[model samples]
Target: MSDLKKEAESLHKAATALRKVSHHTIKPLHEFKAESDDLGALGKLGSLLGATEDIREGMHTLAKLTKQLDEEWQAEAKLMGDVSDAFDLLDILLAAAAQAKKG
Candidate 1:
């Protein structure tokens, strides 16, 4: 249906935006970590880096899974609901990453 197509397009846009933001957000942290000499700070940065990578991977997987859904499944209300929930979580994770970058 047209509505489903619209939803898919919206999701695709969100995914693309998140990908771009996350890349910009993560790249500096990586460079800083590599340049830093403090061991304690490096350990903490390592953990944050790992978490950001996990979040990125999760977003990619969710997008792929959404794409894998057949047309009949995509039409189901539950499918959209589930995908929306996943996006919500991704948004939260991205917000946390952004906050961390700010701090």
Candidate 2:
């Protein structure tokens, strides 16, 4: 395979893997938010529910920014390596926030 083809395949695999990780990391937080809403409606765990909702919003914002970054990165391939790393960092942050809210 040509070097360009190899690189493209590698990048595609990496992106696919990262997308799986992103879904796993974010799914729980969304589930938590739903559960929290049900519990919060009774006036119990209101603060915790509120906090989870805020985190959910932040996650949504991060997801939007990540999409924007991905589009920009595709338009200008400069710093392509950093794009993956930045997304990994965002995934880590989202996972941490989700864990915190779960606890």
Candidate 3:
């Protein structure tokens, strides 16, 4: 194959791998948020843990950042006509993460 073809193939494989792993990467964040919500429900008792709210806020920020990154990536991909299933999967994962933070 031409060097360009080889490079494209490598990039596609990498993107595919990343898309497949995105769920696993984001799963822990969801789990952490769920656990934090449970802990936060403790009301006054939860406050004693110190920085629980900070951690939650940090996760929220992460969700927001993820959303922004996904949006920007989508816009660029559209401009470049480079949209792919792999990136779409990433967008879905990012949206889910953002939604989970809200819920």
What TM-score goes with each of the models?
Answer: 0.32, 0.33, 0.46
lDDT of 3: 0.60
In the order shown, what is each candidate's alpha-carbon RMSD?
A: 20.9, 19.2, 16.9
| Clashing residue pair totals per candidate (backbone < 3 A) | 0, 0, 0
Model 3 segments beyond 4 Å from truth?
Answer: 40-52, 63-103
**For each candidate, what is the lDDT?**
0.54, 0.57, 0.60
Candidate 3 lDDT by residue in tens digits, 4-62 = 44444555665555445545546776676567555546677657868667877777787
TM-score of 1: 0.32
Say which candidate scores most in TM-score. 3
- 62 in model 1: Cα distance from truth in Å? 24
Candidate 2 residue-wise lDDT, 11-85, digit = tens = 656655544554554576556545644544535464755665665566567666765755564444434445655
Residue 18, model 2, lDDT: 49
Q: Give the lDDT ranking, best first.
A: 3, 2, 1
lDDT by residue (tens digit), candidate 1, 11-41: 6665445444444535655554444433344
Off by over 4 Å in 2: 38-103
Pitting candidate 2 against candidate 3, the one with the higher lDDT is 3
Per lDDT, the best of the predicted structures is 3
